[model samples]
Target: MKKLFLTLFLLSGLLVTASCNNDNKKDKKETETVEKETVEVKEEKVVKTPTIVGVAAANENFTTLVAAVKAAGLVETLNGDGPFTVFAPVNDAFAKLPEGTVDGLLKPESKETLTAVLTYHVVSGKFMAADVVKAISDGGGTFTITTVQGGTLTASLDGDSVILTDAKGGKSKVILTDVSASNGVIHAIDTVVMP
Candidate 1:
C-alpha cells in the first residue's frame, strides 16, 4: 500500500509539471506572435514615399528652377529637413530673362549670382498658400520671410494674389499655389525674376 501511494504521488507531480511546461510554451508562442505583428508594423513605416525637394522637383514646368538648384549644390540642402516654401519658376519663365543672362549666370564663375537668385525664391520655413494669403491680407505691411540662404524675402498682397518682391525688387507671380512636399511647399511662378 505504501509503495502504491508513493507511485501515485510521483505520477501526479510529473503530470502537473508537464502541464505547467505546456502552458509556458503557449505563453511564449503568444508573445512571439505579438512581437512578429509589431515587427510587421515597423516594416510598413520603413517604406518611404520619396519627396523631391519641393513640387518644383516633380513639376515638369520648373525645369529651369530644378537646373539652378542642381547647379547651386543645393539639392541635398533643399532635400534636408526644411519646411521650405519655394517660388519655383519654369523653363519658359527663364526664357523671359534678358538674352544671354541665364546662360551667363549658369556658369561656374557666376555661382554666387545663381545661388542668390535660387535662394531668393525660397522661404526658410514652410508657408502654406492659405497662410500666406491670410498674412498678406493682414496689416503686417511687410511679411518678412527668411530664405534658405539666410536672407529675407518680402511678400505683399496685390489684389487677390501674393506678390513676392525680393530684396532687390525682383517680382514673381505665384501661378501654381500651395504644392506641399515632405520638406517644403512650392509656388509656381510665370517668370523667373532676378534679385
Candidate 2:
C-alpha cells in the first residue's frame, strides 16, 4: 500500500514537471518568433530607392547615350540628387549628325561643345507633359527654352508629342516621352536636333 502510494506521488510530480517544461518551451518559441519578426521588419526599413540612370544604364538600347554621358563627364551629375528633365536622343538621333561629328565631339578638346549639347537636352527641374502643355498654352503661341549651347529651342506640343524646334528651324519629334528617373525624366528623341 505504501509502495503504491509512493508510485502515484512520483507519477504526479513527473507529470507536473513535464507540463512546466512544455509551458517553458512554448513561451520560448513565442519569444523567438517575435524576435524573428522584429528582425524582418528592421530589414525592410533598409531597402534603398533605385538611382535615376540605373534603369537606363541597364538598358542595352541606350548604349550610345550611355557612352556620351560618360564622355561628357555628366554621369555623376545625372546620378546626383535632382529632378531634371532630359531630352535624350536615341542612336538614330546620333546617326543624324554629319560624318564623324559624334566622334569629334567625344574628343577631349570638344568638351565644351559636348557639355553644351548634352546640357541643352537637360532642364534643371522636372517638367512633365502636363506642365509643358500648360506652359505653352500660357505662352499663347510657343515657349522658347534657351539651350546650354547659347541658342534657343522652341518647345511646342504637337498632338501628344513634345516637338523641339532647333535654332536652325529644324524640327525633331519626341519618339518616346516621360521616362522617369531617380534624378529626372527622360524623353527619347529620334533625331539629334541642333540648336
Candidate 3:
C-alpha cells in the first residue's frame, strides 16, 4: 500500500510540474508577441516632416523656384539642418523678369549668378511673418537683414503687406506669409528680388 501511494504521488507531482512548465512557455510567447505588436504600433504612428526643398517641390507656385534652386546646386544646402528664412518667388515672379533671363541663368555658364541670386533670397536664421513684422515695427517701421549672398535686404510694411527691397532697388511684395518647413520658413513673393 505504501509503495503504491508513493508511486501515485510521484506521478501526480511530475504531471503537475509538466503542466506548469507548458503554461509558462505559453505565457512567455504571449508576452513576446504583445511586445512586438507594441513596437509595430509605435513605428506606424511616426510622422515625417517636410524640408524646405520638399515644401517647394510639393507646391505648384514654387515650381520655378525649385528648378532654379536645383540649377543653382542649392538643393543640399536648403535641405540641410538649418533654420533659414527664404523669400520664395512664385512663377509669376520669374515671369516679371525680362525675356530670356531665366533661360540664360539656367545655363551652366551662369551657375555662379544663379547661385548668388538664389542665396540672396535666403537668410541664415528662421524669421516668421510675426517676427519680421515685429522687427520692422521695432526698427522704426523698417528692418534691414543680411542675406546669405552677402547682400542686404530691407523689410517694411505697406498697409498690411510686407515689402522686400533688394540690393538693386528691386521691390518684392510678400503675397504669402509663413509657409513652415522642417528646416526653415518660406515667404512667397510676387516679384523676384535681385541681389
lDDT of all predictions:
0.78, 0.80, 0.95
* Candidates' RMSD to native: 4.2, 2.9, 3.0
Ranking by TM-score: 3, 2, 1
Q: Which ten residues in a row have the lowest lDDT in candidate 3?
A: 41-50
* Ranking of models by lDDT: 3, 2, 1
In model 1, which runs have C-alpha deviations exceeding 4 angstroms?
A: 1-49, 52-54, 140-142
Q: Write the per-residue lDDT of candidate 1 for residues 9-81, one digit (tens) a residue.
A: 9999999999999999999999999999999988885545344465566667877777888887888878888
TM-score computed on alpha carbons, candidate 1 = 0.70
The true-structure Cα RMSD of candidate 2 reads 2.9
* Weakest ten-residue segment in model 1 by summed lDDT: 45-54
Q: List the candidates' TM-scores in order.
A: 0.70, 0.82, 0.82
